[model samples]
Target chain A: MSGEPLLEVKNISTSFFSHLGEIQAVRGVSFYLNRGDVLGIVGESGSGKSVTALSIMGLIEKPGKIKQGEIIFNGEDLMKKSQREMCELRGNEISMIFQDPMTSLNPVYRIENQMVEVIRYHNRNLSRKKAVAQAVEMLRLVKIPEPEKQIKSYPHEFSGGMRQRVMIATALSSNPGLLIADEPTTALDVTIQAQILDLMNDLRARINASIILITHDLGVIAEVCSRIIVMYGGTIMEAGNERDIFYNPQNPYTVGLHQSIPSNLAISEKRLVPIRGTPPNLMYPPKGCPFSPRCSYTMRICLEEAAPTIRLSDTHISVCWLLHENAPKINGYSKGKIVDRYKTPSGS
Target chain B: MKAVDDVSFHIDRGETFGLVGESGCGKSTMGRTIIRLYNVTGGEIFLDGTNLTAMSEKNLLPFRKRMQMIFQDPYASLNPRMTVTDIVGEGILVHNIFKDRERQERIFELLDYVGLKREHANRYPHEFSGGQRQRIGIARALAVEPELIICDEPISALDVSIQAQIVNMLEDFQDEMKLTYLFIAHDLSMVKHISDRIGVMYLGMFAEVAESYELYAHPQHPYTRALLSAIPIPDPDLTRKNKRTILRGDVPSPIDPPDGCRFATRCPLVSDLCTKATPELIDKGAGHFVACHNV
Candidate 1:
């Protein structure tokens, strides 16, 4: 718990093997992601938050496996590497950005041969004319305005916010050290999902990198995470500090994912309180608190076991048993339009 | 409850109007210019009093078969190798209305009046579910029995648990088929719960029309007060005592659009006579309207 954790994941677990059998999509899911931390995982939608970012980009596939986890990163464990060393640490040292940028850009290639073959496969002393002039200067550092003739056009000639700024300029042209971003601006348009979350917060402060961000949009994890985790069914359920998971949310599934964020406030019955049922089926999931059957403070030891984490600070934690140390002190997570969610525009 | 800017508002004769906004408002070009499905250039639509911006799709196909449409990607508006009885009997065999096996028993009685399961009568829209491919695109515009249904953003591509089951089956097929709706959407609180006068579009026109509790109780244009202050409100203590109106920029391109009030380039009351004139819907007080030179 003392720094140096740039991306861990311990208990891991991620099953799929189907023919109606194994299904767990990331159960033991531990966390950690430092260096300019962005984190956010959130959930809903087979809530494994995109199978924990495709099990940290090893990009799990065959009836999706990673049956146990480790992932690690800097001290190297990315689950015992090799798919050619997890494809040269996937996009060279971690990078993802999915949620449909027109199904990952390649309508018969052209954004300069898909970002100069990702800077000639992560730099082989560049030069297909300097990797198409540095893929038009990384598509004008992803602000993408006429990046030299919009890199001779094609992923349907941009716009799904410039094909998610050319998939965030091919996930920041291989200058990666973590940047998963699954629902990367959920198929855009909220002012191009706030200009691709201000171009992934100016490419995470010009590539200091470290972001995980998966989403189900709690207003984009309260505007681009500083730390959130939540997840459901495939566990994790809470691990705070995006102001204790959006304002002291002590997990009731991060207070129903901050009461399912819709809030532009003062609502007079155009009502949607939603979050009632539909999530529990990692192929027959439910047992001990996978959000205790849509939890309204469920008890009787939340149907047989599981609720340990609790912790609260040294950067918050939670499994649930309503943070018990003789429980109680509950009530908090209910503020919205981000209750001035502690004035954060990066004041962290 | 009609006053947010209740002017020129008229959907009458079975009524659904619902326009709503956000996601680059224009309410799908005002429901494709009231189902001329785009042409209008400037104003005038008036259907039953017939202006339809001076008709002509062969006199607007007997007013486009009484104005029928219903899209919003029920898997890209059905046709995946068409089948659900020829995508709901291809608009009753293209408006010929009935022929083979009584157009397959009127596409199995418009798929059992939109509740489907006439054994999903030979299916395919990727084998249905996005509320049964929007009830086979509402039995393909109720197999052209149309009395005006535009719909356009129909359940904004489903899944809010099948968007309240395709908005309670488009309000029970508009209360047992009286049917009339423009209903474009971006979900301003489900167009104030299935509109009866809502409008508010922007960038392509109409900044307020009202009557869904008077445009969510008093909204008057500053782009319908930043689109009913951006409809989220699921509640976490009223988004902690509200204050959203965050409309700074973007939504300016309708090609050559901003000389004078195409929401004066993102209006937070922009005025130098709202960039010099083009502001006319005007009325104001009762059937409200507001094209805004400061309302």
Candidate 2:
């Protein structure tokens, strides 16, 4: 928390305009990433976690627009950059890895071609041979066995885990200061996912780069992320350090998410308390808090207007009407009390 | 190619047996084969001590009504053009269990049972969200009133919060109807939570099978150990110090698997004998079954 932030996102709002209506995917989202920090953005489908990452990379396509906000990376406002300028900055200083490795990778091209081209495209001065060597080294760094022979193989030849490794190798080939991984291991098997996560952790220590990990699995976030942001209905429901978010979640949505996941440490006999309903329709999002319909602690004020983000501590913030000073207290509904409801009476 | 080779397990009546494996590991194929959706290539499938694999399509008609399947993707599995009533009542109509007002009442009862309102019966599949569509799928599966249900990754496609809802509903239905379940999924924690016994599959064969608590507490197979170690615990403090037995390579192709063991290709405890002959599932005391030569 001492050094200057590597990336700062201020009040970014992204929306998609279709024939039906304007779908606000991300609204007034703000966060900062320090050097070497692994910040996790955890949310379910349509929670805008992936959209926020895409907005930072300037990859929002037709029908989608960054309606407002500024993205400052290393003291430069990325919104002011031209298309060509953004392209140069993409792989050079900022790289992203997607959920599906097959879609992100060029199927027809060999690993060598895809990786070497990326390396050389970012560093034009480097010779082709040097770039190829760098690509091989990156593959080696990611612990892909037999990089020499594997480099000549096509994407189909590699397994899902290996292809993700290839994607990671390509993403880190240029030593980008910031890496955005959007559910990089979700498609992988658990054992393979562990290997990739270990590889990422090792690389983060060696490369000293910042990472924005986007995933729906809180377990994945808990494994590697230092800080966490809980998203729901295209809004930041809560944000704090990992310990705070997990142990002292203030928002009902965050509490519900935590309780819903069957914990390995807890007794399995206890039933999980599922959140009552589905996510809000973004095309016609509720006038107040989008999560009000599903929240257990939702009050009249929560349905009338959006709750302001209240600071629970120096490092924790949550948007909920229950955190309001004048809000009436509900039985068994407190800032950190919801977590205890899931505890097995017999104890762990 | 044999998608599921020599995989054998039995689900007791009114018991939930979970099958856990990665994609392409043949868990789904096994589920489909048991339900007789796929013709068995080299295995016998017995439901209620009757060999279903040997039955012809005409003869299989009666057994089909006894076992039903709920697919993984509700979005693709449900007919887009069909109304909720038509989808849920189709099974009842086919079996001639009811007609006219009786069928309508049964359909409404099913809708209410799955936690969906009676008004939703007239709506199309496209009108509902992913979770609601899954409820419709469940309602349809329940309409058959089968003794056994094959839930093949039923909650995987749903969001995390919605996943628990469907899981809880399944549990409730199981208690009420005494329906046996063959739950298949890759999510380890959820499988352990819902299942009485768990089977871990690698390639085309089971790596381990035991009671849920026994398998999780003391996994014998190297592949099983690696899989258990790989699951990321939700607690940050616990996960940081956990020693994971990270497997090195990808799962071998099931088309022409290795001679000895399917997992021997990437297993850390592989030996010369492992690559030479396939290991059979051995009984390791207290009903724990393991398929590893080293163990």
Query: What would the TM-scores of all predictions be?
Result: 0.34, 0.96
Docking class of 2: high
Candidate 1: RMSD over Cα atoms?
A: 23.2
Predicted candidate 2: interface RMSD? 0.7
> In model 1 chain B, where is the ten-residue run with the lowest total lDDT?
B1-10
Model 2 chain A worst lDDT run, 10 consecutive residues: A339-348
Candidate topping DockQ? 2
Whole-model lDDT for model 2 versus the true structure? 0.89
Model 2, range B153-228, lDDT digits (tens) per residue? 9999999999999999999999999999999999999999999999999887899999999999898999888998
Which portions of model 2 show Cα errors greater than 4 Å? A330-348
Q: What's model 2's lDDT at B249?
A: 76
The top-ranked prediction according to lDDT is: 2
True contacts kept of each: 0.05, 0.87
Best candidate, TM-score-wise?
2
